[model samples]
Target: MTMFLTIAVIVLIFVVIFQIAKASEYVSVLKGEEVSRKQNNKINGFLMIVFLVLGLIGVWYCNKLYYGKTLLPHGSASVEGERVDSMLWVTLAVTGIVFVLTQIILFWFAYKYQETEKRKVFFFPHSNTLELIWTIIPAVTLTVLVIIGLRNWFLFTGEPPQNAAVVEVTGKQFGWIFRYPGKDGAFGKKYFRNIDPANNVLGLIWEDELSHDDIVTEQTLYLVKGRPVKLIIGSRDVIHDVGLSHFRLKMDAVPGIPTTMWFTPKYTTKEMKEITGNPNFVYEISCDQMCGNGHYSMKGVIEVVEQAEYDLYMAKQKPNYLDVFPDKDPAAAKADTTKTVAAKTADTAAKAAAKL
Candidate 1:
């Protein structure tokens, strides 16, 4: 019954469209003969003026209505982000001026030169001077913009500071994993065959001494305010992207390949909330790529705190799995050996009694 209703609605729509077309044809047949040259000129001129006014008003209000809400948040949260924002504003200003000026000229020409019986139309086809002026101006403008863009790109992508905090962001089917280098400030090697879904999701090689000190978490990336952070990003299953919108940082997390992005957080989470006048505001890390069915749920929070707070948070995290098991420490190893010997002796006695 539902499918039949749907088909009926579609057919009815086509019938209505056909009737509208027939009505338009009849209207054209009657009015087309009544349009005079003077009437055409007057109508075209009026429409040109109306369009010019409406277009400018629309452009003005569009920016006023959506600038802060959708174009960009009022300000940037990082030093590089500020630079990026500035470049964007510069580009917008340049293009906006050209757009408004060209639009006004086009409409003015249409209104001024609308078909009129008394006016003689100018027949000159082209001017080398005018052509050269237009061509040179755009070429020069583009060259300047490109130069500025490349300079800023290099500045932002240059080598990170020595004190930059290193974090590894791993992307998988529908979530992100954050790994922080522990006391040694180095990441352990990873092996694909060693990937344990429950314990070692990153396939970190447990035998590597560095793996013992690595801190891994599935949620809440923690950072220190006013410190540079270097992110090493990778993907396990498919391509994903790490987008830190507030910081204006983005990089692809490609499968079987590693990528990196770096930025400094100028505002702590608390400070940003106060700045934005929203108490619940927090920095977010989102997947910008469409990787799978659950891609929309692939998001994480970034908590920026003071340096002391960051240090305290790191100190409380548990060590890697290998450190707590297998008794790697000498004292713990001896105790484990003793326990094993006692258990073996007890098992032997129990077996002999059962045989008797």
Candidate 2:
């Protein structure tokens, strides 16, 4: 019913417009074409100035209204992200100046040069000097912007610092998988065919001892504040993007191809919550690209903490390997051995009492 009403209203609007147009045509015929054209031109020139004023107001109003809601208010969560923020500001400034100047000139010229009986139209055929100025200025400005962007890009994707911690990120149908290299600081080999939904989420080769301690997790990725983190990203099924808007960095997670980027986190989740004045605030990871139907649901969280807190968290995490092969877990084996020894001692003591 709502849709029908909307359609009816739209149809009524068209009919009204048509009638107004026909009435205008009759009036134009009565007033003569030359006089009507001049009047319409005057109206359009006045409307242009009004539009320019309103548009400028709207731009300012929108920025004022939504600026606080945007990530820009709190600044970046990563040190490297500060550069991204800087670049963005520079780009916006350059483009914004150009936009305002162009708009002002365009509308002001239309209003000032409106058709007048006392004045004649100046035929601006071509000015090579003007053309060169416009072309060269934009080209030079764009080239400089591109160079700055490229330099930042290279630094982001380049080799991380020696002390940087590395983590593997894998994207699947509607979720993210994170892996932390155990004490060995290496990741095990993985085969696509070995992917098991139940136990082996990352398809790590058990034969590869290096993989035995690689920690695998799904919902939350952990990092240390003030420490650089290097991410090795990939996809299991289709293309996905790892968007860290808070950190102001993103990288593509392509199937069969691993991409990498690094950044040093400046604040922890606890710190951000305080900074933003939102007690429930958490750093979020969003899939920037449309992967599939569940792409909207594909989200991950990052928990940044101090080194000691991170160490404690890591200590509590049992590797995916141990989960798959519990018998091989030294902790489990030790417990089993202790239980067997206790049972044996109890049985021996009982036997001695029975003999007595």
Q: Rate residue 75 of model 1 by lDDT.
A: 77
**Which number leads on lDDT?**
2
Against the reference, the lDDT scores of all candidates come to 0.86, 0.96
lDDT of 2 at 334: 94
Model 2 worst lDDT run, 10 consecutive residues: 200-209
TM-score of each: 0.82, 0.96
User: How do the residues 123-237 of candidate 1 rate in per-residue lDDT, one tens digit apiece?
Assistant: 9999999999999999999899899888877766677899898999999888889999878888889898887888888888878888887988886999999999888999988
Clashing residue pairs for model 1: none
lDDT of 2 by residue, 67-108 (tens): 999999999999999999999999999999999999999999
- The Cα error of candidate 1 at residue 212, in Å, is 1.6
Instruction: Give the per-residue Cα lDDT of candidate 1 at 235.
Output: 91
Candidate whose TM-score is highest:
2
